[model samples]
Target chain A: MDVIAGLGQGFLVALDPINLLYCFIGVFIGTLVGVLPGIGPVSAMSLLLPVTLSGTPESGIIMMAGIYYGSMYGGSTTAVLVNIPGEAASVVTCIDGHEMAKRGRAGPALGIAALGSFVAGTFSIVALMLVAPALSRVAVAFGPPEYFSLMVLGLSILSFLTQGSMAKALLMAAVGVVIGLIGLDQINAMPRLTFDRLELVDGIGLIPVVMGLFGVAEILTNIEQQIRRDIVQSRIGSLWPSKEDLKASAGPVARGTVLGFLLGILPGGGAVISSFASYAIEKKLSRTPERFGKGAIEGVAGPESANNAAAGGAFIPLMTLGIPPNVVMALLLGAFVIHGLQPGPLMMSQNPQIFWGIVASMYVGNIMLLVLNMPLIGMWVQVLKAPYKILFPLILMFCIVGVFASGNAVFDVFVMIGTGVLGYLMRKFGYEAAPLVLAFVLGPMLENNLRKSLILSEGTFDIFVVRPISLVCLLIAAALLIAPLLPALRKKREKVALDATD
Target chain B: MMLRRAEFWGGLFWLAIGAFVAWQGWLLELGTLREPGSGFVFFWLGLIIVAFATSIAIGGLRGEGPLLGDLWRGARWRNVLLVVLALIAFGFMFERLGFVICSLALLLFLMTVVDPVRPTISIPVSLIAAVGVWYVLEKMLLVQLPKGTWVEDFIPF
Candidate 1:
């Protein structure tokens, strides 16, 4: 009932030898993929999803969660050493981190990043412990209408912020919803898009789609370009930050933790936006703004802390409200559903061990990451030297085996291949897969809620606008939809004015 | 001329898909607003898709987009095609040829044909990886990977 008691029980679960082993494996693999350029946590998690099926739910979830945050720690390594960001969250780290590496301060830069990540990660877990229960209490009051509105707002924000054309992104979301409609109708139990195939009745398998889209598509994209990386040749100096360096970085790290935690609660692009925002804030606050691009410790400290904190904060919505704020959370949501556990307000009350065990594991995982990364930095660098040609075939094997073993259906394999090709084309055309995946996951819930709300209102279209929370969500969705168009409309009006003057 | 652009073609493809879904939803009978039917959401989603695709098509009509050919500009089509074919063949023969033989062949082809490592290296590596993965999945994880219909009859392992 109390936070302390819950955490005490959680530590008991997390400390169990099996869960600890899985956590270590997760973070270790996370760091490996995070150091390597092409593969990411999403692919790693998806590949391991089936394997975790054999383990207890606590161990399975602990492993997956470890991969999510562990990658955040490992991403900085490549950014500091090779100037290639292992993940999108690490992009900002490349700016000052690589510069520090060039200046022979790579060790301190990396040391500060790990230290900052540990502090922010632990801070976020404490924050999560404090905040999640309260939020779930509030979320318990929500009805179907509120859920419908929330999903609408979530999808709109996701599509609006996705890189490239908003129209294209929205179109992809629509496509995803359509694809999700393939299974037997939830209400009547009649197949909608099965086309007489029995497998379609169960719907398109999520594992196959994810593995195909993120895993296979990535490999296809990477092989298009020649694989080459230039490792930083200079000696990595001492792995400790000096007193002056720590003092200089403390302020940025604190600010980044607060900013990242707040931003990570939002629906779309939170981690990325927070990292960039933290960098901008630090640069603005700096007396020596000119020093930012040239090996400034603050640059490395702020964004690294922000991204790690953001990863932790992103778990809140999924845990409390049953809404995933990002793609990684979406996969975790799938994992929860696979384990026959529904994550919502009731989850905290019903499954305290699972809820708190994962929370406690973050504490263990963060400490493990610090220990793993600091002494084993050279080993991670050695992992980066593994050739892409050799690595890819192994990755491909994992994808195939993972999918086949999970479902025991060859049809799923075909689905993966088809989606993989579609994913590849989508990437080449500049359409992002995040919105699509998120929309697909949310589609069934959205439709079910919409129908329920309509039935409650007795066919009146006024139900959505009549409810205050629903009205606010719809209004926000409308704003996000129109927000992207304003800039384009303004540009057209400006062009018209210039033409008239000419 | 607009159709020469990748965006235009993509938009058209989505438009066709939208139209088809809308037609299917209609046939499923779009229920009244009071108690929505299964088709009600699909119908509206289809319409929304159509609207978005139409707008994309209009933008593409300006003919200021990358050509369709640009999609494969730097791709090694030969390698890509080989990998796809290998996967399809593997999936096709998974149960018939068994996990070990099919996976080994797939790896050998990828290493030797698509990317072209020497046989001396590709042979042992493929054998180890294929057998190693089978042991892990089937034996350790207790997943039921296919044991090959024909090959199992002979080897009986």
Candidate 2:
């Protein structure tokens, strides 16, 4: 009942002319970024982040969120139409989506993906409106012990779920944590990794690390592979899904929404894992599992829904706790701070308008995205015609301007270049950049919570066990960390995956 | 032989980096707390990297695979060289020529050097992009850009 009222208030906020404008702009830019292969929302947002420093946090945060969710909506276009994934989340969509393209059903594959996404996105937002406040009530009571436990879970889940040997993932995760420790010590106001340079006082900036890893690393890898060979245009026939296609997708969308929402609330690998999980589940439930990698519409429907739901779900932890669940959310946190608003449980109590306003903005953004994306997808297809050579320099310049303007410092521009080089090296060596980006974003928070938790517990480590929420979170983390190790669990999981994919 | 060549070179590089970092670490005051000095982390990470490089060298020497023949497949060294040189030039030109000219030059060089293309099409496109972008960023959006001597008269009010 209360959720309805909150949503009404959100609508009031979102309907405001300025907020609406920002939402539209966010979706427009997001769609543009999402259509281009080798570039994603992270780079787009980072390039624009510094430019938004003048706006109220509400407008800024809403705009960025619009971009994030909007990109999710647009990410599948290239995957289905062009056989290239614009983002990692869209990779699974490519398996069946591209196959569907080759079968001359690209239009239906795309249409169903968009429709499933809209349904899932809207459902999840509604769920967010209802579940967020209740969760916030619980989160408001969290202590440092709980926060620390949550972070540990975050690190462990991120380390374990990534494909490849757990040892390598753990090694990368460790490197990320250590790199994150580079700035300053959260406790006692002492610096741990700064070596005399005055700019080192604030440690390394976030935009640089993120842009370097996801953006520059991508450029390096893509350049190394010369993959721009012309692909034959798949016949893009009807824009509407067939009756059977709709029937097949309906159940997957529903299941994906529920599953994605649940996973999104967790600490790490929320959206990425949810998409993978949804694809796996859809294949398992299908009577024609063999149809999956060979142009199955259900494959695209499930994961697309799941990923959107996961995006919506991510807002829960961020709003409920001051802690951000991922790098994107962390950047949102920075925006919130800039806007003179602090997001946490008390956020609702202090500024209902801003809280409900942002919530309402999501509703507005999702609708704008669906409307904008469906009709203009043809225009988006044209975007693929632009060559990477022409685009690369523009990207580099955007990075420079963005980093420099963030604090109005040239120093950060240097940071962007330095991180770009490091990121390039990492890609060459087969080290993943995402964990490092996540670590850079989460490092300070982890440190702050650990030190604060220790202080709150009066140096007694047992406090982490006393709290039920923290204990449960820790247990989840332990399970995730150990899951890859247990031979039974490993075999079962793989069998489950292979069987589902069969 | 390719992995060996890479690894031998990598080992030498890491060895150099590690020694340099360790030497630098000694100069930084440790502050006596043993909580790990600012330099300590880098020193140790570098040493570990060097050790890993050594192992890679040994593995490569064992010739686990045809490293030489397999080296350049899908490898695009030209792209790296283009980007690296362009960036160094861009970095230096940033303060001197300002963002507009530097970015334009970078865009031009990148299109020409990184990915080979027909210059007849690329040149005019690059110029228009450079000038068009300059107008949008500086004239329309009101971002202050570096004023180059030649473009002082071209600066849009």
What tens digits encode model 1's per-residue C-alpha lDDT throughout B98-128?
A: 8899888888888878777778878898899
Q: How far is candidate 2 from the true structure (C-alpha RMSD, Å)?
A: 4.1
The runs of at least 3 residues in candidate 1 whose Cα sits more than 4 Å from the true structure, single-residue gaps closed, are: A488-502, B118-120
Against the native complex, each candidate's DockQ, computed on alpha carbons, is 0.72, 0.26
User: Who wins the lDDT comparison?
Assistant: 1
RMSD of 1: 3.8
lDDT of 2 by residue, A1-502 (tens): 2767877887887898988988898888887887788888888888778656656677778889998888888889888877777776787888899888888888888898889888988988888888888888887788777877887787677666555434444545545655676656555456655677788877777777777777776776677676773433865777789899999889999998899888887766667779888988888898989988999888999999998899888888888887677767767776777677788889988888888888889888888988987788788888878777767666776777767667656677667777787777655544456666676666666656765665566666677888898899899988986786689888865564453243
Count of backbone clashes, every candidate in sequence: 2, 0
Docking class of 1: medium
